[model samples]
Target: MASADSLSKLLRCPETRQELRPLDDSKLDELNEAIRAGELHNHAGDEVEQTLDAGLIREDDAVVYPIRDGVPNLLIDDRIPLKDSD
Candidate 1:
């Protein structure tokens, strides 16, 4: 299995095909907060119940794919949309 750093270099958004990189720690904290608050949902419209162990974010920061057990779940329907901030 490839290391997360190497995998990130090869990963792309399944829908937009944008380059993906490991989501930064600060952003991960924010994501966890929303998840704990029962406020985040995936593209499939299901509430994201599990706190992400890690994640990959697209270049534009529009969405994130959760990484579980060192494997990225690249399914389009599993992608979580990000809220825009002013």
Candidate 2:
């Protein structure tokens, strides 16, 4: 359950080698469960990737984002911010 700030810095695409800046963690839990229950699909619907890549959606208008590795980077920068705001 990594925070959004941490996830942002660690998130990266394996194919295009691009960095992903998705926005909700609490909501992300639903996605993770959906992926597990087969309710939702992956980048290639109906087919899931082995990696933690998962997927992303705006999730309402509150900025609920996703994460990778074991942490979530919510910061709006390339490097992890030392201080995060609530």
Candidate achieving the largest TM-score: 1
Worst 10 residues of 2 by lDDT: 77-86
Residue 78 miss distance in model 2 (angstroms) = 21
- TM-score per prediction, in order, is 0.87, 0.34
lDDT of 1 by residue, 1-86 (tens): 99757866888887778999888999999999999999999988899999999899989888999998888999999989885530
lDDT of 2 by residue, 1-86 (tens): 99777966665543334455553456455555655765543322233322234333322232222346745434332122112220
| Highest lDDT model number | 1
| RMSD list, candidates in order | 2.6, 11.4
Candidate 2 positional error at 83, Å? 33
Candidate 2 steric clashes: 15
Error of 1 at 43 (Å): 0.8
Model 2 RMSD in angstroms: 11.4
